[model samples]
Target: MTEVCFVGDADCDLQYELLSRETAREALSTYDLRRPFENAIALSTVSLGAAVSLCNDLNWYVVRFVDDVLVREPSVDDDEWLSRELATAVRDGDVTGPDTGEYLKVYGLEEPEPTPEDPNPKGPPALVEPLYVSRQDGAVPEYDLRDVDDTVVVRLTEGEFTV
Candidate 1:
């Protein structure tokens, strides 16, 4: 299965925005949605091509409400995710195998703080700003932007590497 995860902009309510719009809602009607992170929505597709197609189908809404589009194809790497552009490239045969691991965007997985009302906070982790890095010797550096319980490493194509 290829999973596509949509991370929303800080000010947007991603779920409501996508589900409320007729076109976006229609495009997403077939899949079961999952929230793997705060302000994010995820769905699974049979293959990388289908995942890219789904993203393309929702591009209008994605551009307006989404901050990031991440795709995970188990055939590539089960532990790391791929940027939408990279995923598209892979599906289109522009990238393959170990070449996919060269550039990366590492995001910190920050857990919500405990509050008086909810001491033991239990919600999806918030993804922090991504730190773009290139892989060296088959490994990328640890995320050091902030304190986080974990990190999500997203592979990127050369075109999508901001830094």
Candidate 2:
């Protein structure tokens, strides 16, 4: 099976923005209706197709938020659930949570950078500023995983696929 991630690049040269969860959901819905999912490349293709559909709908004339990618100047909505999920994962110690160094070591990914050689690195930064969380009043939380102190890596593998 192919691996899928919520990887993104917010400040690329192209200058696109991230969408809130609700907007993304709407995009997903439109994508679902526009394209029929196939088994050949389920996750990756579907995400790309949906993103393209959304772009076509909005007339953005660019690429952004396809699959687990965030190309261009992505600005997520304050009330998006994925943001919360990421926060919870970090706080609850999920696999894709914090531990930037460890994430890089395992997946060969890199956190976002001003001039990144690899946009889709194995590891990514856990917390970013100006995230636009809905409940901005409360002290915004970061990396509240099960063991905030521990570091871990979780991968999905199948026959003939070893990393």
Candidate 3:
């Protein structure tokens, strides 16, 4: 199966910006998946066709995030639900919300640097920032699957497909 993950440096480089549910809904609309990604890649054998389709759909947002990521810099909208539930939290002097670390771990990913000494870093703080990921559920890909895939890797039998 196609492992849905932020596997590469390129994907990690994409700032982990958590979109508000409404904002994400809008983003989804751009792709005609106005609804949640109700699709599934087979658990153990993702077909080439499914991978191609998912890869293509994900590529569009990758481009979009690269272009507009900075505009929503985390210093302002760092937390996940704040944009929806706590828009005035910062201005009202309330503690905002979670950071990059708390968010990325949910996806079994982590960004070691939450803040850098550069004083003016180049990209989003690692792990703490929730990067935009295309998903099979509601806003931001939620691994809220009912049946988690088996942790054990399954290898094909040596002669399973041989004549």
Top model by TM-score, which number?
1
Please tell me which model should have the higher TM-score, number 1 or number 2: 1
Off by over 4 Å in 1: none
Candidate 3 worst ten-residue window by lDDT? 33-42
Measured against the true structure, the TM-scores of the candidates, in listed sequence, are 0.97, 0.20, 0.22
Q: Candidate 2 on 19-64: residue-level lDDT in tens? A: 3444544544422121111101112223323433344453332234
TM-score ranking of the models: 1, 3, 2
Better of 1 and 3 by lDDT: 1
Q: 17, model 1: CA deviation in Å?
A: 0.3
**For every candidate structure, what is the RMSD over all alpha carbons to the true structure, in angstroms?**
1.0, 16.2, 19.2
Q: Which residue pairs in candidate 1 have backbone atoms (N, alpha carbon, C) closer than 3 angstroms, thus clashing? A: none
Separate clash counts for every candidate? 0, 20, 9
lDDT of 1 by residue, 63-120 (tens): 9999999999999999899999999988898879568998899999989899999999
Q: Model-by-model lDDT, in order?
A: 0.93, 0.27, 0.27
Error of 1 at 143 (Å): 0.9
